[model samples]
Target: MTAEPRTHRTAPVVAGLLTALVGFTSSYAVVLAGLRAVGASPEQAASGLLVVCLTQALGMLWLTARHRLPLTLAWSTPGAALLAGTGMVDGGWPAAVGAFCLVGALILGTAAWPRLGALIAAIPVPIAQAMLAGVLVSLCLEPVRAFAAHPLLVGPVVLTWLVLLRLAPRWAVPAAFAVALVVLGASAARDGGVTGALLPQLAWTTPELTWASALGIALPLFVVTMASQNVPGVAVMASYGYRVPWRETMVVTGLGTAAGAPAGGHAINLAAITAALAASPDAHPDPRRRWVAAHTAGWAYLVLALLSAALTALVSSGPDGVVETVAGLALLATLGSSLAAAAGPADGRESAVVTFVVAASGVTFLGIGAAFWALAAGLAVRWALSFRRRGTPSADAASGGAERDAEPETDAAAVPDAEPEPQTSTR
Candidate 1:
């Protein structure tokens, strides 16, 4: 009889492990790629992997324990992609670190100021989606490049990912990584052996603030993270009928980001897709037990953190394009979704196209990368087009009308999900 209860308890625990496994395997390669693109050495990238895992794991545990809700956090995969797109800045790694610190500060500022959050929400979704799609285009093409450059090494990985995507979409990325692991092992044997420190170690670099990094890296990273991860995370949790304490949650994540920045972590925010994995009915029959799933997932990420160094070492010693192939495959779905989302609201669709082309062009001017320029150009075109439309003003004036209409709903404490399900979120 007691054994039955134990088995019931095990359900959420198992689900939690699956959540962590999927979450980690799905995107850690992208994280490493982002760090390296931003000028991190192999050791620094290893530190980054370890620190992001630690901060997110600890953040999840604290939030779940405190609120008794399945509130989970993740390193910003979109932000990492932005880093990869931005590449090495004028000041190199230190500048990137400074930009990370700035993103954390911006997140904290949003929590302290409601207007800030509202402003972020006000940005047209299509522009953000376009920018993300553009950034991903270059990375998503890695497989094509790899297949052409080293067909033998890249072919099996693509085949594995394609087969699993048809059979079990969720496991597709992880399966691709598994096949790549075999490829890497063979490459290592041919090269004699793997190389890199197996033990986890911290590599700290004092952050150096520069105007180029600030405008190019910080602002874009912050916007992508907010639009893709934090906003969608709130919506996902609300879909489960949980009124996430938005301000408090932001504060925790913001603080965690700042704490991890020096050690090479970019940023951390609420988990969107993975949130559903733990918060849904699939996690447990009783809603209260759902928090246990998040808590268990936290421990799972902690375990993964221990392996970060060794994984980093293997990736460093592995053949070129093999790891990039894995990262690119991992991001393909995200790219497709972002592209689809970018093709919306016919009025500004052209603006989104302009944004996409500019960003994908990989053009940089005055040390500012294409992402910032893409948004600027998109907004410019959008305004120019809107001027001619001469439509009546807007359905609602601004926050004043919104507040008046939502007052009653606010009194009822019904969670309002103002954001759509993000197609751009990696995890």
Candidate 2:
């Protein structure tokens, strides 16, 4: 048995703090950029940043405590990236707020109607894992890229993590974070000691409904969010061997998104990369106790929200790749496991590789991110490879064709975030 007393004590808290730190520091800029791109004023963009931190903090708190699972919620980074690329719409920031509201309603709608989440769940396990590995490639590369760019700054942080990995495993990530903070702090001290508003000012807009805004903003926001954040989040957690309550998760996150929209927050959904930080074995040896990490991450986020104004300034002014390097280090373990799983069983390994390649390539089509297309491509490939003559029975130890057709169920359930439906036919 992994010793109970020592293992659970500080590891989860460290994991939690690390989760909040990386999740916010890495993406708050993108969130601000997205809000600004859609015509939010400076104050409005700050409000967006402030509210997303607070709202998603609450969702993570509620979900982790209620279900006792290592579930984390985050602002939709991909959706925010989409926003950054999109120009101002007809109703301006208010119209963008209207779109945010629509995205929330659509999330709640997904909760009520299970079809969408179900279809996602039906995707095979190797394929889901492949998508996750693909998604992580860009993030996992940051450390190497950071060190190459600024070896003087990022090198020490990575060295600290590596030394600790052999000497003391659980604390490696937290130590790296601590080192990065020093690097960031030293950089800030040189440049006038981190000056920005400690108090965040809120700017609220009364949302306006417009057809142009709906088409230009709302639909696309909703689509990219579900495809990139929610679905992949479920897959990520399931890879760690957890079943998220689909409807309940939607209800909590949807409520958070709706509540924060008026205050300038965009979509909030399940965390993908940071979820690995909290749920991975490094958090704790016992899977059951790992929720402590997620719960701690929730409280850490609340604390971060109070400090968001200060942190926003610090992070914005700090070294470019230091924080990202820490984040990449944290995800290294996850990337290793995912890569191994992506190779999968012999039958589906080729399709899984296709999925991983597309997801890692980071291509976009029809305003949707690579993840959606990666999954689609994998499924298509699997179908083509599995196709057989209608009347011919496959060569197998099992006698009947019934057994061969039922195999995907066993395969998909390897990650149980979504359960597969039993097959039924009437002749």
Best by TM-score: 1
Lowest-scoring 10 consecutive residues by lDDT in candidate 1? 410-419
lDDT of 2 by residue, 130-202 (tens): 7767766776677899899999999999999999999987677778877877888899999889766767767
**For model 2, which pairs clash?**
none
Local error of candidate 2 at residue 353 (angstroms): 1.1
Model 1 lDDT tens row, 333-376: 88998898788555558988999998888788898888889989
**Per-residue error at 82 for model 1, in Å?**
1.4
State the local distance difference test value for candidate 2: 0.74
The TM-score between candidate 1 and the true structure equals: 0.91
Query: Distance (Å) between predicted and true CA of 4, model 2?
Result: 18
Task: Write down the TM-score of every candidate.
Answer: 0.91, 0.65
lDDT of each: 0.83, 0.74
Assess the local accuracy of residue 19 in candidate 1 as a C-alpha lDDT between 0 and 100.
Answer: 89
| Deviation of model 1 at 76, angstroms | 0.7
